[model samples]
Target: MLRSSLAIATVTATLIATGLPAAACGEEDKPASEKVRVSGAPGAVKNVKAVGNVPDAQGAIAMGFLQYGHRDVMAVSGEFGLKVYDLTKNPAAPKLIGEVSLPGLWETEDTEVDVKRKLVFLARDPRAYGGTTQTGESGIYIIDLKNPEKPAILSYTKVPAGHTTSCVDDCRYLWTGGPAKAANQPADWGGRPIWVTDIRDPRNPKTAPDPIELARNDGKTDYVHDVQVDDEGVAWVSGRGGVRGYWTSGYHRDPVQGKVRRATAFSPVPYAGGGIEETAAPSKFMHNSFHPSGHRSADGADSNRWRGRDLIYATEESFLDGCVGDGVLTISSLQNSYNGEGWRSTPEKPFRLKSVGTWSVAGQEGSDPTTGDCSAHYFDVRGKVLVQSFYTQGTRFLDVSDPTDPKQIAYFRPADASAWAPYWHKGYVYVADNTRGIDILKLTA
Candidate 1:
């Protein structure tokens, strides 16, 4: 059998010593324990208050913030199952109102909530459920969130691959992507491609029989890690080969064919993208992407930073032995990627997009060497500041007003925190820690 990642052993050790199951939730009333991890600089932004704990959270990876009428809830996806906490009453001390057990689920890496549709999509990855790399049943678990106090499963569609899944066009469809493969994938392919699913009918979902073969990256169907939809209705997919953008709806100028074309979830036309410049990235594994549109993209002091241009913020995830070999944050100019040259390149003709800048935490202040797998995982961009999760390095806040030279503004690293992703919500930052739990923090100068 293939071995687990280096950090998995450490996590196992902690679970054993604490007498907590590898995949179980801690009690809500339990007080903060001395065993919980916490480490950070005196002046840096620190956890204002944390609700979930180690024993309660098997391994929290991703979370979604939602508000239905009078309830503001946080949907946390972890090793054990999906948990929902009400944050409206108290943002820090979230009250656990509901959850659904997904035994043998492997891992719910990420969950997306459709506010209008009152639906939630949970991702089940093969790596966790089957404990294998290339084989297993992966798909999305649909849940009805109409009743926050009690969430019920609407349906489950077993797709080709499911490392991550996201909603497109107001919950009308979903783009599922991955770390491994389906039973019928091409033998020589490195990873899985984006599979489309129709969920217009919340009770009954339909998945396309075939996966999206864009012939991206030298005409090879490489893996697509994740998909993020921007306000302008552009769905961006990121993975090993590189990051690419697509217009899922409406007729737009095809950056590649240089002609206006129709677009849909199953057959999205190439909008803007090419391979990420390898020379600028330590690792080519693009984990996820974020693109803020119009006024939202210019929230902070970096008003003009992305005013007239489209900026693609991506997280590069790598498991290289030392921290130096891990992935970094890549910022690329979407306009530059659409210069009408990179869209048609193939193996015979190679081309890559220009990176606006790339940032890493090798020698950053407050960095720790003992941290397990110090690489970028996931991030959320807000205004000029980008809040990112760096495995064991903790949560970092960077100033991206100047994309070419990102500056570290603040950080929160508790020695035991294995922060996987960060989400900005209601003026507060919520960090999904794989080892600890959901850490709540606020930016302070």
Candidate 2:
């Protein structure tokens, strides 16, 4: 039987950890945990184009994967685990060279990569860990990528909020846009802000700007659904269907003498309180929570909440069905601004000629996971490819050559599909299909 990449799944999607082991990160060289075996796709053909298989023996299915650097090592995160592999020798027919196992860290919703640090970050899957109701930062595991075969376990930080969708370089910040839902009874439907963490030390990662800087999405409107940062480390978050003027008003705080004072009153728990609480924005700081607003874009000759594409790209995921499913891909550029002396605010507008694009799943063949919900929906690394998988729509690829004119270039859908996100590795695709199997795809230029 073919061995596989180190665990493979959640870690790669949340941060960046390619296994092949480049020369070394600076001079701090490290070794992998064990000797990973060389495993191949179950039934491979010539050129292989792409291959997909279960990420680990447990079989949660690989959900996300990423590759980095001139060396081309691969890192993929999944439903139950995280792993990295080396595809440098054979990009087409990559063999498992390195791997990591995150037993309780399954249900990996998404991942992001920091190639420079040879690390892959994972956003914990609430369902797998305990349930959406259980509040706590989904486990954040970082994999050392110096030696693919002998990769080391860097550290796993516990986040008390929900899991994050992506992380930026500088390794200082990572953002999770999902609302802090109830740990087990996920029906509260709270709107959460983008939980940004400071991982400067990695071992003891802390929330930046503080977790108390935001609120959750109410059922009536959109909340911050997803986010991404640019090379400059500016965070662009999508306030799916943002609404204004709604918050916990019962609580109060005051500046007594020279210090900020506070008061409180009992109220129903925040959306997913007890488990998923609003980041921690107090009523007194409600204005602070909504400081950075949207500006108009050039095409609309309008404004958005931010500007400058150098630091980030924040787009609104079209949520339909009264704000449950995804509909459009809101496109815009971004740059961070220091406002009111570090109060942190951004005025934005549509960055491109068009700020909205219909990314509805159609014409694709597959048994989608949900009746209609796109998860892990995102723009690819080349910044030219928008890759996302609908729970039922399958893996859809759009040629973002024009960002504004993001057209479907290629797609893959399996009849009777399951619930796994699709990932791109060295022009190839890897998917942890709910229970079907891990799949690989080779995309054309």
Candidate 3:
């Protein structure tokens, strides 16, 4: 993998000379003539700042936030490598400060940034630079962000599964998910299982030599797309089968099996889980999720109680022709699933999760007329507000204070938008747009 070290440096130098902070490709040599398409109801969010590109706009995929001293730095991951921009000087307009070229780095949906430890974990999918799903080398690249301006890669440990990697148990361990099945992998495996990596020693990160495939609800090697660990230290693995919550490290009675057990990264004991039961939901393909506890209903009647009642905000990433079967956000109750047949149940007797609410961009206002993917991708939840990305639909803000009836508070949808993910930081929203680059927005009161 290090064979492209020289090429990486060469590409970096060329890009620097071309003058970054320029407009996206197809308009790099031109001026800012095209007006940015902005839309939202009156008193909605405002697009205070709009920029073209950061470094490699064409390959810009995901965005991560980090705060260094009083300055705010954002790391954007793309095809070639990762780019860090200093947003402290001006949140609206970012200044490119660092670049690390990774020539063949594949699809990086999410980059886990440990601001406390000053490290960023970049996952390398099996699908190589060309975007082919064929088996290839998949792993995570550990980068030291101690010097924000000049980042360095500590090491790249090859893991069996690598579509996305998330830090668990306070950055001491990393649970990498998604399969780029190796030659010796089991033939019956569907997609991927959770692969544990002990990164307590960042310099010498160690991953299990063999794959740890946990038999999921379907009694099959379920495809674990992404893992979202809640504030309560529950690692929720979402995939084709559904979403299952596991206790990584804790001493609690199993909600489903009704037994006392210890959990760990390598061996996750099931807490609670079930399939999403929504008629409008096309596929059961659950992308990613967010678990918020201690949330009371709008009327202040029901709240997350002592027994650990919480709400699961999940995004379904399904795409189809003519904007049909687009993904949406499904709100489910963890308590309902806990009382039912959870992770311990088998395929013969499956229980469905109770979906409380669902919000989509199917018939929503400000939708692009052109044929494109309207499916929801990655999103960020801040309090009662959920900022989600709906491909060409741009970024939409939904007020989930009333979980059942989510009100559309604000939105920023450009005609040519290819919005990927949205993150709320410092009272502002930063969206990773594939077309118009990173769009900075401010939510008005």
- lDDT tens readout by residue for model 3, 142-177: 998889889999999988888788888777888887
- Candidate 1 lDDT by residue in tens digits, 1-445: 0011333353355445644321111111111121233344332334333443434654677788788777798888776678888888788777788888875554555578898867889877765544444556678899987887898999988888776788987779999876554546787676678789999986788999888845565677766777888777888888766778888889878766668888888888777776777776544567778766643443344343455666778877654444676678988777766654555667687677778888887678868765545667788877778889886688899988788899998888776667778899988888888777788788874
Rate residue 221 of model 3 by lDDT.
69
Per-candidate total of colliding backbone pairs: 5, 82, 0
lDDT, each prediction: 0.70, 0.39, 0.67
Q: After superposition, which runs of candidate 3 have C-alpha atoms over 4 Å from their true positions?
A: 1-56, 179-184, 210-213, 255-258, 278-280, 294-309
Arranged by lDDT with the best first, the candidates are 1, 3, 2
Clashing pairs in 3: none
Candidate 1 residue spans exceeding 4 A from truth: 1-55, 296-309, 339-342
TM-score result, candidate 2: 0.56
TM-score of each: 0.86, 0.56, 0.83
- 10 residues in a row with least lDDT, candidate 2: 281-290
Candidate 1 residue pairs in backbone clash: 25-56, 26-56, 39-413, 39-414, 106-129
